[model samples]
Target chain A: DVKVTQSSRYLVKRTGEKVFLECVQDMDHENMFWYRQDPGLGLRLIYFSYDVKMKEKGDIPEGYSVSREKKERFSLILESASTNQTSMYLCASSTPGETQYFGPGTRLLVL
Target chain B: AQRVTQPEKLLSVFKGAPVELKCNYSYSGSPELFWYVQYSRQRLQLLLRHISRESIKGFTADLNKGETSFHLKKPFAQEEDSAMYYCALSGLGGATNKLIFGTGTLLAVQP
Candidate 1:
C-alpha cells in the first residue's frame, strides 16, 4: 500500500515565525506536490517537484516555498507565518500520468 | 487556461437518498478528471478517476466531454459517505502531471 505521512497533524506558530511542514512518501514516485486547503476554497497548489532539486511554482506560491532534496520527501516552508497563512496543508506524490496519493495533512494555526 | 469548478459548497442529504456532486472544467485539450475524498480526521485519498471507469465505495463519476463535466454519483448515500469531495483535472499538456482542483463540496449525510 502507498503511504504518505506528514510531520504534524496540528501546529501553532506565532506571526513572523518560520514554519516547516514535511511530507514523506513510502512509494518511489517521481512527482511531489504541496497544497493548502481552505474552507470554500478547496485545495490550492503551492509548489510541486518532479525530481530531486527541481521545483515549480503552483497557483498560490506567494507565501510558501518547497524543497525536494530527496526522492521520498518533500518539504513546504513558510518564511514568515501570517494569520492568513493558517490552513490545512496537504502533500501528494504520484508517477507520471498517474493518480496522486495524499498525506494526512498539517493543520497550521498562525497567531 | 486550465480550471476546475465545483458549484456546490455543501450538500446535505438523508441516508438512502441518491447523491450527485457536480464538477466542470475549462481546458483547451483533453483533460483527465478525478474525484478525491477526505473523511473527517483522515487523510485525503482518491475516490475514483474518469479514466478508470470503475466504481469505488458505491461512488462513480462519468466524464462528459460535451458538457465539460465529470460529476460524481452514488445510488445510495450512507452516513459514512459524509466527507469533503474535491474534483481535480490534469493532462494539461504538461509532463509534470500537475492537477488543478475545484473548491470542493462538503457532503453531510444526516440520518
Candidate 2:
C-alpha cells in the first residue's frame, strides 16, 4: 500500500521555538504539499513542492516554510512557534494531477 | 482565484438513511473535483474523484458543470461511515496543480 508517514502524530512546543514537522512518502510521487487545517476555515495550503529542490508558496505561507531536498521527504518548518499556530498539520504527496495521498496528521500545540 | 464551498458544517443521519454532502466550486475552466474522507484517528484519503466515475465504499459523486457542484451521495449510511468529508477542486492551467478545499462537513452516523 502507498504510505505517507508523518514524523509525529502529536507535538507540543514552546513559544518562540523552532519546530519541524517531517513527512515521508513511499509512493515516490513528485508533488508534495503542506497544509494547516482549522475549524470552519478548512484546510489552507502553506507550501507545495512539485519536484526536489523546488518549492512554491501557497495561500497562507505567513509563518511557515517548507523544505523538499529529496523526492520522498518534505518538511514543514515553523520559524518561530506561536499559540495561534496550533492546529492540525497534514502532508500529502501526489503524481501531477492525480489524487493526493495524505499522511496521518500531526496535531501541534504551542504553549 | 478558484475556491470550494461546503455549506453545511455538520450533517447527521441514521443508519440506512440517505446521505448527501454538498460541495460547490468557483472556477473559470474545467475543474476536477474530489471528495476526501478522514475517519477518526486515520489519515485523510481520497474517497472519490469525478474523473474516475467509480464509487468507493458505496459513495458516489457527480460533477455538474452548470451548477458548479460536486455533491457526495450514499444511499445507505453505515455506523462506520462517520467521518469528516472535504471537497477539493483543481483547475487545469496551473503548473503546481494546487487544490482549493472547502470547510469540511462532519458526518455523524447514528445507530
Candidate 3:
C-alpha cells in the first residue's frame, strides 16, 4: 500500500506569517502536487512538481509556492499568510499516467 | 483547459437503496476520468478509474463522451459506503499527470 503523510493535521497562523506544509510519499512517485480544497470550489491545484527542482504553476498558484528538493518530499510555502488563505491543503503523489495517492490534509487557519 | 463538475453537494439514501452521483467535464481532448472516495477521518483514495472499467466497493462509473459525463452508481448503499466522492479528470497522456477535481458530493447512508 502507498502511504502519503502530511506534516500537520491542523495549523493556525497569524496574518503576515510564513507557513510551510510538508508532504512525504513512500512509493517513490515522480509527480507531486499541492492543492487547496475549498467548499463549493473543489480542489484547485496550487503547484506541482514533475521532478526534483522542476515546478509548474497550477490554476491557483498565487500567494503560494512549492519545493521538491527530493523525490519523496514536497513542501508548500505561503509567503505571507492571510485569512483568505485558510483552507484544507492536500498533497498528492503519482507516477505518470497513474492514480494519485493523497496524504491526510492539513487544515490551515489564518487569523 | 480541463474542468470537472460534481453538481450535488450532498446526497442521502436508505441503506438498501440505490445511489447515483453525477459528474460532468469540459475538456477539448480525450479525457481520463476517475472517481475518488474519502471516508470519514481518512485520506482520499482512488475508488475507480475509467480506463480500468472495474468496480470497487460495489461502485461503478461509466464514461459518456457524448454527454461528457461520468456518473458513479451503486445498487445498494451501505453505511460504510457513506463518504465524500470526488470526480476528477486527467488530460491526454496525463499531461504531467495533473488532475482537476470537482466539488465533492457527501453521501449519507441512513439505516
Name the top DockQ candidate. Answer: 3
TM-score of chain B of each: 0.96, 0.95, 0.96
Model 2's interface RMSD:
1.6
Q: How high is each candidate's TM-score? A: 0.96, 0.96, 0.97
List candidate 1 stretches off by more than 4 Å: B92-94
Tens digits of per-residue lDDT for model 1, A14-54:
99999999999989999999999998898999999999999
Cα lDDT tens digits for candidate 2, B65-110? 9899999999999999999999999876455668899999999999
Candidate 3: list runs displaced more than 4 Å. Answer: none
The weakest ten consecutive residues by lDDT in model 2 chain A span A93-102
Which candidate would rank higher by TM-score, 1 or 3?
3
Alpha-carbon RMSD to native, per candidate: 1.2, 1.2, 1.0
Error of 3 at B83 (Å): 0.9
Docking class of 1: medium
Model 3 clashing residue pairs (backbone): none
lDDT (10s digit) by residue, model 3, range A12-76: 99999999999999998999999898988888999999999999999999899888999999999
Per-residue CA lDDT of candidate 3, range B19-94, in tens? 9999999999888999999898998899999999998999999999989999999999999999999999988676
- DockQ, each predicted model: 0.75, 0.70, 0.78
lDDT over C-alpha atoms for residue B22 of model 2:
99
